[model samples]
Target chain A: MSTPDDTQFEAAFADLAHAAELMVDPVDSAVIHGRVRRRRTTRGALAAGLAALLVAAPAVWWLQESNGDENDPPPAEETTATATPDPTTADESAAEPEGGPDGQASEDVEDPVLPAFGDLVGAELELPEFQPDGGSLNDACPSGPATLADGTPEWEDGQWYMHEGPVWVLKVVHTKLEEGGPTRAVALIGCMPVETMVRQAVVVAGDGAGGWEVTEEVALGDTSDFPLFDIAPAATAGVLLMVTDTETTGMYEPVPVDYRIMRYRTGSDLEDVTGEAYLLGVTDIEASVEVTEGEDGTWRIELTLTNAGDHEAVGFQMTACGSDSFVLEEFDLPPCTADSEGVAVYEGLAAGESVVEEWTFTPPPSQEWSGDEDSGMYLLGDVRPTTYSAEVFVYDPDLSNNGFRVDVTPEDVA
Target chain B: MTPTRGTRHPPAAEQPLLLRPTLEFDDFYAANVRTITGQIFAYTGDRAEAEDLVAEAFCRALARWHKVQDYENPTAWVRRVAWNLATSHLRRRTVAQRFLKRQQEVHEPPPDGDRVDLMRALAGIGERHRKAVILRYMAGLTVAEIAHQEGVPEATVRSWLARGKAALAGRLAVHDEMEER
Candidate 1:
């Protein structure tokens, strides 16, 4: 057998990468933004000067509020209430009339009981038209090929082993299209073996006479990759089926990425209403420079750095390039220098933070001075105007605002 | 180096909150979240966990945007933070216990067999090798970029990539044989 080349290896890795990309669920930026805001609020509260006083005041109220709010029952979608509560009566078959005004009681009166969602669906489950001809659900999931292509009977014991796990009925949700309308019962029912699990949704509607019938059976075909298992009532109407993809790499952590938001109305098929998820977070540092002429025949160079984005700019090494030229012109300020040790000279800038530095330099006074000399100061033979530009270099993510330059001309000098 | 003397202005929070800028952070977050999350997901094999880790890293970045924004590559910093968080979280969780619990509960749809095999192989490899492969292929980072971010020599990154590929191939080949049989 020939060995795979580098190109093949690269292609295979790239393919895996692409598949992983496709497998990821959309990220809700708003959710992340909320988390950040909450963290910041907590942090700010901690940093407040009156933190102890504030905490003392809120602690009492929070404890009382927490008792009620924290213990509140979970939302309706997670509840086991399979059928909608009727406003007027219980079951017509079992419910008894009220006692007479004479305070006499009826002995035969008994409240009605609702049937379990699983029992109702399981007793009426029939393979939808979309499913291939197979054994009844009571037989459990169909066990495929008893052997392998190599006639190995042990193949049945391999990864594809299909156990005869019982038919499983998942969550049942009760919702209605409009107020006072008949409540709809939506649930996910399926047969789970070891590997291949079949999923189907049975939607039943109340006839308002305590009678219920399966109005629509949705055939959710082979969900071996991304399973649409959980069912909940949609915010507006119908039912919402959530797809959860499990990550079985090294650990068995189940990652729930509300991957798809599918809506199934009474008569309509499953519709994809997935909203777009995008990224939201960036760094921006604004830089500006000012050059002004002083009455003392000197040029002033000012550089200002500001953190204009929501994030704080940290450990940025600010370099005022072209400062060495100013050093040759008898500048009152020392040359802006960065050490070889890579220290962050400017430190950091928080959101809406700014810093300013200024330097003043005097040009050559006479034309009799030598152009080249042993001294560090430059000697000019003429008063011809010279332009010195200063620029800032920062590690800002947004390069457009990272650097700022300002030109200072000696022509303005007297 | 000591910070140069400069006139410091009040923080933006002191001014009207509306005057603070946010568009840049939003744009940056929107641009890199998907790719970064995907890369982390490839490494961890859990998309939801990866997203949470990435979001956390970005949150830290925002908190210190003044400092992080000045880094040579802010995205790289975010990725490293996320990878570190993933490692720590994985270590904190009891994998064996979770596996047992998952087995008893209603089994979720396992990822594609090949994908599962690939992830299993990745898990068997060295941590550095797995990170290198994921960042290189999934994040589409160049060898030099990976080396710089990983704080290693480019040659070392190349070696890790080669060994990672060989390990994956060997494991996948065994899987294929078993499947074929």
Candidate 2:
């Protein structure tokens, strides 16, 4: 009752079961399954791009499934002979947060005078040079929960974007060892905010035998554990650590000193790779300033603000602070009180929206003698040392990337 | 959210039908993913590609499990979708390879043994015949199901299956003879 076709088909089916055994085991399949499930939940940046944009659910699955080993463009892992057209635009898997040729342009729309989110210029800050082969991230992803609790040098920074969706692998600097050993990848991950800091570093290197070897992890200043931001790799031996010294004890204006240091051992020195600034986080607000002096020695300070991030920037405040000399000499205004007459606040903006506001103050009555007080310009050698500099602050709970000095007129205003 | 092991099932009206399929789908996934993956692997010739296609097929099924579960054979649905994913992947890769070959000398990754033999045999049998054989053996699709998917007569499908299998058997016999020598 068995035809040649029937028996052969049975044999082939059995052979296929054997082949399946050769390919992916139950654990491997579960890993793939978990990844798909995780991707559905943690698609921070992927949710906006082509993956989420596709109308067909199957297309998204196709793109996700096709993502092959790290190093080659996913979707186009192109192992399938029929050539599944990768739905991912920009040449790889859903163009996530970093490293794209067109990255700066997106960040450059620059929201209104918002605080400088510390030159987080962006992950795409380093490209073409870094994404060698464009396929590593597909494999470089962490296998389990992305947590900094262990600080284990695990490849995957198992954190979700804002803990909402999409595993945000925010910053990864991929470099090979000196003599071309295994490729080394150091990524700055932001998942859960412990004390408002979601920064952690996980280093992974090639095992020289095709698998990845996670090497090191340094975060929040390991010792102080102050939430670190603007983390990027130092040229050679180690990484560049930048943190807004938030815990700088009481009193005195929080002179937001941007601390960026090369964190490495003595024998090994950090080198400069890219001159471009790679920020760990992104800020929604952008600030710009223009100063115009009126006929009566009065000056009109104009400020503008814009919101370019996905979230709404609420309670926008632009505060102008100054040293004693500049406060009294440059603006004839009352002695600079903290945020009194020195601050301009506005209702926040939704993404892509902008707002403008202005404040006017007259020059100091006595210092107008120009020829006498070191060019009468606030302070000279200590030139603008006493001059009022305006800083914009959006009510970010973290306030880490939310404070920046706005440029005022008279010096380098043009 | 999925109900835990001991959790009581809510009354029919209170529970959404969509949410109810999780357990069923899990069972189905556990039962079929391995089989479907092997089937896809044999058809695609690359383990990673096959795995990807299988996962993609399952992902699509998960999205529409409510309807898929209603079908007489949900696994067949996954197989069909997975086949599309694999073929599309292959079609894309072929174009890239052709383009690369035009510009420079391109080397292909070595195909595995049984898969290579199967691929060559399928090619010898011709596209339509090969599709029927694959749907029958690799995807576990019955002749009528292949006929339905291919929009052909059942007799035509059976004929393709017969010819494709004969071609495969001939090729394997030759391979076996060579190996023995």
Listed for each candidate, the true contacts retained, as a fraction, are 0.15, 0.19
Runs in model 2 deviating more than 4 A are A1-5, A26-414, B1-19, B100-125, B138-140
Task: Indicate the residue-level lDDT of A250 in model 1.
Answer: 11
| lDDT for position B105 in model 1 | 28
When summed lDDT is taken over every stretch of 10 residues in candidate 2 chain B, the lowest stretch is B94-103
Per-residue CA lDDT of model 2 for A1-414, tens digit only, reads 223557656785567556655565332334333434444453444332322222111111222211121111322222222223334322322322231121111211111111111111111111111112443431332224332211111101111123322224444443322321222345555433222324455564433322233455444222144545444333222445555445221112323333443353223444332233222122345555567777776666655566655444433444344434344232333223332322333433556777765656554544442343333333110000100000111122232333333322334221
Model 1, A5-102: lDDT tens digits are: 66775666677767766666544555445444544443342222122222122112211111221122222222223222223223421232232222
Tell me the interface RMSD of every candidate, in Å: 22.3, 18.9
TM-score, chain A, candidate 1: 0.30
Residue-level lDDT tens digits of model 1 in B1-181: 0112334435766645643335445667887777777777777666766766677677656655555554556677777667756654443222222221222322223257566787777866655678887777667689998776654569979877876776677777777888899
